[model samples]
Target: MSAAPEVKSADANDRANAISTIVLGFAADPMARWAWSDPSEYLRIMPRFVNAFGGRAFEYGTAYVTEGARAAALWLPPGVEPDEAEMDAIMEESLRPEIAGDIGAIMKGMAEHHPLEPHWYLPLIAADPTWIGQGLGTLLMKHALRRCDEEGIAAYLESSNPRNISLYERHGFKIVGRIQSGSSPVVTPMLRPAS
Candidate 1:
């Protein structure tokens, strides 16, 4: 059998590949589709959204990739956060006006459910569609959770796709609450307590 894929910190050189993996992984995701229903819009805006939402992982050396960027996880260390300003700007410019209120409510709910205490946040994790079912997701999760365990700090993530809840649970995460708004898909906020 081939050796298991090794997880490594993603550098700037890996940004495009890593982000593309996430984009393709989320193509069928309910929350993502609800936000950008048009295939063209999704293709155009998702890259910016990924960068705004989890790009810090790249700068902080917390972005992990494996199998030649076939899978990626963007984890924000304690006190680090998404670029809210850029995210807001992107949404304001790209989202359909009719769904603006729903989007706002969803964002508000996400913030309300977010843990106030410092924690590692996984804003995004995905494997290229063609690479699914190969343990890449579990590999990435274990690689990051190892650090969380070592530091005795909690880890948090919101599941944008219901299909992924079980995968996160398998890694020690528990659903703490849910976030939803008019015409929007449910977003499950999960937390893994410190070891």
Candidate 2:
């Protein structure tokens, strides 16, 4: 039997490609839709947000980018989730002042639901818009989950876009909880036990 094609683990050298993939991939995501109501503002602020988000993943945990930047995934390894200060920094750097308070509450709500047990956290994962339905997402998910299995750690993620829940379900994730704060987008938290 042959192994799956490898998705490259991103490093400092892959920063630009990985950031671009994340921004393009998540531009229309539910959270983005709720936060950046203006298309022009979304275009301007999303890249900064993704850069900060993916940059943390790249620096502290595992970041993967498929060939041609079609897909990307950010996984924070067990015990590597960012601290309060880091989260505050991320919000400050990525979000606009007008939307900051609301997004911060959403972030806090999401964080409160995170599993206390050690696990791998997937904060961002996406396939480029042009590459959707082409299996790039599956490739990245499988690759990262395999690593989690090897390390004997559970996997966790919050699906901001309901459309992608089935995709995560297919990869062994089950909804553990749901988060909805006022006007914020509904977030479904999923967990996949270590195999």
Candidate 3:
């Protein structure tokens, strides 16, 4: 077997490539497509959405990428969070009226399922379509979860694609609840207790 890909903390120089990988990885994601059904819209808005939702991981040195930037995971450490205001603005300006109306319920559902205590939140994790069969996802997960385990802090994430649920479960995440807003795909909120 070949050597496993290395997972490293992504720096500012890696920001564009890392975000582009995630954008490509999530191109067909149900939740993402539901919000931006138009191909043109998805292309235009996804990068901004990624930035608004998980860009802080880069600043905090928690964003991870595998070799060739084929996979990425953005983990927001305790006390850190997505830029809610920017996210709100992005959705407001981009989503269709029908989709925009559901944003409130979707946000409420996410908040309700989110852990109240301090924990690491994985807002996004994905592998480029070209590299889906490789072990990059598992590699990235282990790299970040090691830090969470060492810190004795819990980790959480919402599975936007059902195909990825098994991968998260294999990494010790358990589905706590489901979040589904009007005309939106099911989002599974999962948590991995502190080890």
Candidate 4:
């Protein structure tokens, strides 16, 4: 009923919240086929890679209360930084081990190309399934994109649910590629300009 909630800067501990929320958000999508539980899987692995991008990882939430908030969030790692081997280690040691994503090809491609360079990931932008149509995704995305503009960098993400394609388009992302992992479409790569 109210205008959702105010979006604000997230603290250090919010990174885990953001990652876990993303997994939960796509859990039901027939295309996602994601495999992970709430809290434990994401929280345990986030710290290992939170600082991977150096002094640029950020988390923002949309809630009156910080704690216990299913806040929509974004994770924008540093731009122009490269740590190829380090990123490989993060994926092998933490991300894949903790979150059971079926998209081996997606992970493999990420392993090939470094992710630390100028990009934003909407890793956790869910606001309770019941509240989905309330525009929380767009609100969170806008907040993330504004920061990306302030820093003059690009944003990237892969939408598992085809239904969300238009939603992403409205936010300046154009589908760059698509892939099928297993029986369902694994990921749809989208990029938003820094300009």
Which pairs of residues collide in candidate 1?
none
lDDT of 1 by residue, 87-145 (tens): 99999999999899999999998888778988999999999999999999999999999
The per-candidate count of clashes, in order, stands at 0, 0, 0, 1
Best by lDDT: 1
Candidate 4's displacement at residue 22, Å, is 3.8
Full candidate order by lDDT, most accurate first = 1, 3, 2, 4
How much is 93 displaced in model 3, in angstroms? 0.2
Q: Give the residue spans of candidate 4 off by over 4 A.
A: 1-4, 12-23, 31-68, 79-102, 110-117
> How much lDDT does candidate 2 score?
0.80
Error of 1 at 133 (Å): 0.6
In model 2, what are the clashing residue pairs, if there are any? none
> What is the TM-score of each predicted model, taking all chains together?
0.99, 0.86, 0.98, 0.63
The global C-alpha lDDT for each of the candidates, from Candidate 1 onward, is: 0.95, 0.80, 0.93, 0.56
Better of 1 and 2 by lDDT: 1
Which 10 consecutive positions of candidate 1 have the poorest summed lDDT?
A: 109-118
Candidate 2 residue runs with Cα over 4 Å from true position: 1-5, 83-101
lDDT of 2 at 159: 93
Report the lDDT tens digits of candidate 4 across residue range 6-42.
6666656665565455445555655433422345655
- By TM-score, the candidates rank as 1, 3, 2, 4
Cα lDDT tens digits, model 3, 10-45, are: 999999999999999999999999999899999999
- Taking all chains together, the TM-score of candidate 4 against the true structure is 0.63
Worst 10 residues of 4 by lDDT: 59-68
